[model samples]
Target: MVDADQTFVIVGGGLAGAKAAETLRAEGFTGRVILICDERDHPYERPALSKGYLLGKEERDSLFVHEPAWYARHDIELHLGQTVAAIDRAARTVRFGEDGTVVRYDKLLLATGAEPRRLDVPGTDLAGVHHLRRLTHAERLRGVLAALGRDNGHLVVAGAGWIGLEVAAAAREYGAEVTVVEPAPTPLHGVLGPELGELFTELHREHGVRLHFGVRLTEIVGQDGAVLAARTDDGEEHPAHSVLVAIGAAPRTALAEAAGLELADPAHGGGIAVDERLRTSDPDIHAAGDVASFPHALFGTRLRVEHWANALNGGPAAARAMLGRDVVHDRVPYFFTDQYDLGMEYSGWAPPGSYDEVVIRGDAGRREFIAFWVRQGRVLAGMNVNVWDVTDTVQRLIRSRAQVDTEALADPHVPLDSLVP
Candidate 1:
């Protein structure tokens, strides 16, 4: 074991990095831990940025993972407003910014996280076109929405991922006229399969939001340096006062690549390659969160998930591995989104093209239901819409790897609790 004074350096002060620092302390490692964040604030929650926070229903302080005092109380060094310029793995140090302040680490965690993927289409640089990845971006969008007087404000959300839908819901709640444009046939088609995808599409449309599917955006039209509309590939121009680009995120792996770490397949989408224990090819450097791709037991392929739960759970798992603890990092991945009076929760892993049966447990038409994606008599994944209790039972079933009865799962008369392992 290394000396207690051995320094631990964590890059990126987002959810994963912050949690890793907290976990290191919790694991009784009284080491010299330094958290380097590009932003000025202490780590704050990002999920709420597109939802309650953006709507002004939540304060900035409320989003903080821990208060500014907590970091001090824990005695964790906070290096704010410093971007890691390069990682010198051979030298066991990281150079930050132009001044090149070097931080030496015995062990390093690359929780560099991800950045919003921008569209290369014309007029993307328009003033009103924005991406909601960071708190600042959300703040800017919120300010514009509030200034425009949400009521009857025309807002076009280009992309139909969780971020896009959540932002669209918030804009609608403020009485904005919202239009969601998605290139896919259904929103969340890549994540949620067809049956659940159809449910989400219907859910958004029911809430008075216009939904356009199977159409690609060609350009963001501008007037006087501000966005005016979005031109589609189908030769359609949809007018809007503001536009949000929520086309998903690309892993922030530049520093890792610079350090000569093995990168995962771009088809797996530019995440760092790591073993089950979250150890990167370098072994001394570990990666987790959206930046790391590991083999999934359920999917049987290397996968990367950009969910809040992964950062929450995986950060601690990596810390344990660093401490030489035998910890299996397998758990049901979970994510939730609140949109249009619907609380959507999903858990477990969905193998691609493996769900042969979809069993609905509640009324989809009533905007409340749990849909189970079953393959080979086992529950691979499940989607819950306003039926959160079912998620607990699904987690248990997934952990136990239990065979689920299709008829019982589909039967609304049966309690989901009855299916628990």
Candidate 2:
């Protein structure tokens, strides 16, 4: 029999929620664990959706984070296709959709995650304009890709972020002419910084993907209920048969906000406020993944990190905390993106206006390089492009908070581990 007192309710069936449930069970909580997901399907991996999955390189079954039989064997009650209408913090209950069923919980984890930001421009609602976030979105894009004739189709992608670049690469692989429009001066400028962003721009260009930087899109033009082109702020129209809006993502925190949970400052966008323990204002409720903005031990500020590592790690951390374990979330932020034939891995935390020097290792021209961000002679962040082993060295350097010799770090002759203190 399940322990009634250990009933844990998890909202949202993404990586965070599913992992949290798994962690709870692994921690010997043989209790009632209920996972509520608004989506009809079981929790699945999302990172591949924008890359291999979109290109039809991977099957839908491979995207699942956990198999149905696994959940059943673990005794996890999955409530799929059920919307959480509201959360009653005081009563420790969650109300669902029109059915008005209320489920009470001793502890609750809100892994609501985030939704892809959509283009609000004209013709955005047209048939060929889409945003890549969910399985449904990928299915639609796959359908469109399959229906295209042998002639190369024009695909206009809004925003030059990782998703946009990945989709562009996939589209190009399918013999489609891809155009990426970004208001920023360079692709991934907001995340990768200018020098690295320039490298990414070159990589995309090398793949025959047209990139329009420092250009704001004014509207998405469609004809006869199908997207035809995207109009820029410069009064230029780029013809396109399909448009993928991969601008960014917004945290899904409406239910959390309505439940009277304190939210993060809007100046930092719509992320939910949480402590180092991933506990929200209400002690009974906790949050993880993209929806959460928690204090960074290294950066000395709060941040909302939207990365696969964060979702995978943060979920279990929150679950452990909910199970009366006192644990501080202090992992250095890490993420990676694959574009064309290049793979980029980044590690550590970089506080704004703090890095004093950036040391590059290996040759950028040869499609292999690692850049280290240093502040006060201490390594703060590192980016490795096409060099997988650099990630191991970077992780250790970040954890040790070591000061690296710039000369050794910048020298291609020296191995990355030699720079680690």
Candidate 3:
């Protein structure tokens, strides 16, 4: 049982922490909910940082998870721009800042998310080189992209992940020449497979975004601390005034590691390890979102998902688990992305080689389709691309895991619900 008079400290002010606080209150915990964030802004959606927000289609204030008044109204304390220096699990307290202003908690939640992986190459510190993870990074890159547009400049993008591709689309929309350098044979080959990646390849090529597949980036050449071009290992150089690195992100597990939390095996993409309930080794401490790698009950392996939906869903589950409820974070992993005019929503877990076949519905040539990964006739994963009002159906198909007829699954005339059984 938790003491009603005690405080509940939540580290990291991202969506997971904010949602956990909301869950604690909604579930009638009524204890002190203190959320600590290193960033100055209130909790906001990070996806917009590379997409709608970067393109200026969404306002800065609109990105916040809740308004300033909402936190006060909910009786949640927001410690903006405050760094949590250390955690004393034995003492049930967290120390912050150089002064080490210690805050003791009856229960603690670690929602510290992932950070962008940086490049080790020379000229990475150049003025025009950028990485997008936070709002400030997007703000700076937005300005740089706009400047490039006005000057009819070029921006070199290293890596072809979602962020890189989305930003490439935004930069193209801003009328700047864009080139994406990828070490993989196909962009997003690991996740989308070669077929879907080839479709994306066509999409970018159609939009005049130059893509260099199977190319290794050697370095970013700069003039007077400003980017001039990106040199490839193959000795090819793409001229540019700005460079954006979007390789990938590494989970921010320093605090968890320092505090002696059990970490996942490094071979499994090292992260703070937690059970299905999102409870860390310490009974009073919980972890959620990107930093916590919990065993995916469906996939039979631990996964740390760096997606908004995971954070949003995992938070409430962790909150419930913290409140002495038997909770399993068993929700299907879902993530959505908007690049150019194409919007995509994917659900379920499909480990590499787990699926025997991909059954795609609709016209792939037209860029409107739903792709499903089937293993032993059961739907393992599904993705709806440029499809309307079908994500719920896709999720249902995945969760139900009913042996679906590949023909019916691929039939446009057949409603998705009809194939559910």
Candidate 4:
């Protein structure tokens, strides 16, 4: 039984850490809870930063996970704008803040999350260069988008991933010209493969966004400390008043590394290696969210997911395991994206080469369809675009691992639930 004498410390103030703290209290744990965050703001969700909030459709206050007063009411020690300098595993203590104040813990949860990958090319430090990973970045970008639209300025975006595409859509809505540069043949080539990635290319092109496929931004050219244009490897220069780097993120695991915790292989996307219970090699410590790489029994591979759904669910699962409850962090990978008029939700993992074929069930041109990635007649992953209320059925099909007929899977008349058997 967890007693009041025990103190649980949580590092990193992202969604995962915030939810873990909430779960501990809801589970009737009387122990002391300390939540430490390097950011001054309360724990908030990141999806809004790229989607609604960035587009000005959502207010700033909506980003927070909970009301500011909730932490105080729950007797949780909320330390904002503080950093954990080091973790002394043997002493069960963490040296935090600039003063090096030490705080001991019976159990510790690291939800350090990930940081945006930086652009290494010259002129990246120019006035209009931007990267969106935090609320502050979103706030600045939000204003920049409006100003660009008013001035009819051009915005060059690097990468055509979710962040890049979403921001491209937002920039277009703001009436700013957009030029996206990607090394892949199509947008989202890594996640959706060439087939589905082509659809995104058409979507953005229809919205008046220029896409430079099969090329990368070699350098961001600038004049007078302000962005002037983005030079591509093809010897083409796309005029730009601003540049947004959306190349993806790297998991933050420095603390876990310094503490001597076992880490996952780099080939598998380096992260703190954890078991089914989200517990690290050191039994007293656990890692969740983007920082954790756990073996997925269903997929039969160790995976690290940076999606919002993982953090939303993983935190609670980690907390349950901390309370000595039977828990397995084997939830299927899931993610969603909103770009222009198209909205999509993808469940299960079927990165390129994992599936032998993609079975589509609706009109592709209309942008209302369900695509399933199947291998050996078993569904490996599924994505529904502009389709609603079918996520549960799709996930059930993935978990069942049952042989599904490609003909029936692609038939709109065939109900998805009936194919499970």
Candidate 5:
């Protein structure tokens, strides 16, 4: 049972934190709802940082989850640009910054998000070296793209993950010659597998983005305190006017660790360990978004997803759980990306090499297709690229767990729904 008078304090005013507050208000928890965020701006979508925002296709005003007035209307006490310095779990209070401002709370929600993983190579701290994780980074990079005047500037991108690739695409769109470096045999090999990774490789190649796999960066060469080039172990030197490091991210778990909350094993990527209900080891505490590692019903394994949809969906689910509502916060893992003319939507998670076969409908060469991963004739995961209005059918195919006929699924003529039902 939830006490209406108990104060609810939410840390990290990102998507998850904002959504959790929205859920609390919607669920009739009228007590004081305090939202704390280190960023100066309101909670906004992150995907735009690499796509529309970076490319100048969208305005910053449209990125916010809600305008400043909305939080005031909901009576949510919004604290921005304030870092939580300490959490006194025993006293049920949190300390803010150097001022030692303490706030008492009956219940706490940890939505602390992830931050960009820094490159360990030498000269990484030099000027012209950048990483994109927050709105500020994107805004800075937008100016860098403007500086790189089209067709004359060279930008070197480190890593080939979704963020790296999207930033590369945006840079190239701005007329910079972009080069992507990946140490793996193929980009995104760990997540999407080499087959699809190579498809993306082709997409980048067609867009005039040079890709180098199976190579590691030795050092970032700088001239006069500014990055000028990067050298690789493979004896290749990339002359870059600007360098963007997109090498993954690490979960912001310092708060959870300091408070002695149980965390996922280091081998499991290290996040706050939570049950399906999003409750931490302490029932009075809850977690959501990238920081929380919960059991995945569809994946049948403990999974931590760092996607927009995960934060959007998991926040509300955790809020309900915090309110003592009986809820199983399990949903299919879903993510999407846009690169050049290719728009990709992927639903479900099957461990790499676990899927028995991949059935394709439509043409991969033409940049339009739906790829389905099957295990023992049952659909495990599906990806629809440049094919709109089919995610519902694909998600149903995965949740239903009904065996599918590969022949009909691969046939473009057969409707996806027909095979599932």
Candidate 6:
């Protein structure tokens, strides 16, 4: 039933967009495929921007999702360095670039992704103040970190989120002085809650990273168009040669908004509203990755996930749904972080009010343990720190939604799989 003359257009050239195009071809869709990207570089994953690539452990060529010739070889039209200005739902066309070239599509996929939130204080435009969301930003920050290391320069990181902590670790590895400022009581306060958050605070302290909690960055003071210090609400000035604003990110839904597409409520981490099949209000248009907010059946809530794994799996799920195949994106929310000698993987959603108690297995003092957030005896989420090959067990515990005894869950000798039945 393939429509050979139909055209499928994908906007954004990140992991989700590229993967969706590849999925279409792999599924034997002989239709016209077009992909548009605002960045000049080929599609790439974003994890390396804060991990190996930033630390100089990964080569530049490893970032791209495909080689430059891959698209042409597969007969996929790729338009790089082009931004879509408008989306015409009625005409099924998208206008982009200075010349306003319009492309028609029978089916459309929006993988626009998200943009990093900017610091709203004075001197943010000054040199040495950085934000890491794109490859260009990471490339510049990598060199800045090396120079800072050689000069023993001080780096003031605003917000102790994943990006901030990862960059801080990379900076420490490069021998640069790092100071992280967070308004919360601990690092990763929103994600891990205070209980496990304290563990991260101790980890960074052991690695010589200065942490200032219960304080927000008020202003960035600069001299000669370069950052000099970061002023905090706690009435302290931290001397800084460079500043990093790793606050958070907002989904890029401007095009969807202008086109009058239904969007999720802002309180629910707003993005383009989609069903379980990733289809928008207009059936011809679908969305995936960070920009798509869909109802999660297991969590019984609408969630917009911005992690790398979501993009890795959501793209193909959306592609199959586009091809008239039944698809439901119900993967458990997952993410990971590496700081210093510790590596951790988190599965399931356990926001502050959702989980009543947290259970820990193994020893926290040794930084080798698994933590589970439980609500009324049902496991809601789990995190394994410095634990190996247990992701499957952790995710199974979450998906099973089985009531587990607190003592047994906390016992390291107890097999996790045995608790499910």
**All candidates' TM-scores?**
0.96, 0.96, 0.97, 0.99, 0.98, 0.98
Candidate 1 per-residue lDDT over residues 363-410, each given as its tens digit: 888978888888888888888888756677878777666787888988
Query: Which ten-residue region of model 4 has the weakest summed lDDT?
Result: 213-222
Whole-model lDDT values for every prediction: 0.85, 0.86, 0.89, 0.94, 0.89, 0.93
Stronger candidate by lDDT (2 vs 4): 4
Cα lDDT of model 4 overall? 0.94
| lDDT by residue (tens digit), candidate 2, 35-130 | 999999899988888878988889999998898899999999999999899998888899989599999998999999999887767788888888
Q: What is the C-alpha RMSD of each candidate to the true structure, in Å?
A: 1.5, 1.8, 1.2, 0.8, 1.2, 1.0
Model 2 — TM-score against the truth?
0.96
Off by over 4 Å in 3: none
Q: What is the lDDT of candidate 6?
A: 0.93
Using lDDT, give the best candidate's number. 4
Write the number of the candidate with greater TM-score, choosing between 1 and 5: 5
Model 6: weakest 10-residue lDDT segment is 412-421
**lDDT score for candidate 5 against the true structure:** 0.89
Error of 1 at 109 (Å): 0.3
**Colliding pairs, model 3:** none
Tell me the deviation in Å of residue 71 in model 6. 1.1
Model 3 scores a C-alpha lDDT of: 0.89
Candidate 6, which segments miss by more than 4 Å at Cα? none
In the range 1-421, model 3's lDDT, one tens digit per residue, is: 7657979999999999999999999999878999999999899889999998899899999999988899999999899999989999889999997568999998899999999899889889988889999988999989988998999999999999889999999999999999999999888777777767887898888899999999977899988887889999888999999999999999999998899999998666677899989999988899999888889767778888889999999888999898998898978888888888888888887756778988899988888999998898888888889987888888888878688889988999998899876
Ranking, TM-score, top scorer first? 4, 6, 5, 3, 1, 2
Model 4 residue 262 CA deviation (Å) reads: 1.2
Clashes of each: 0, 0, 0, 0, 0, 0
> Compared with the true structure, what per-residue lDDT tens digits does model 4 show for residues 75-156?
9899999999999999999998578899999999999999989988999999899999999999999999999999999999
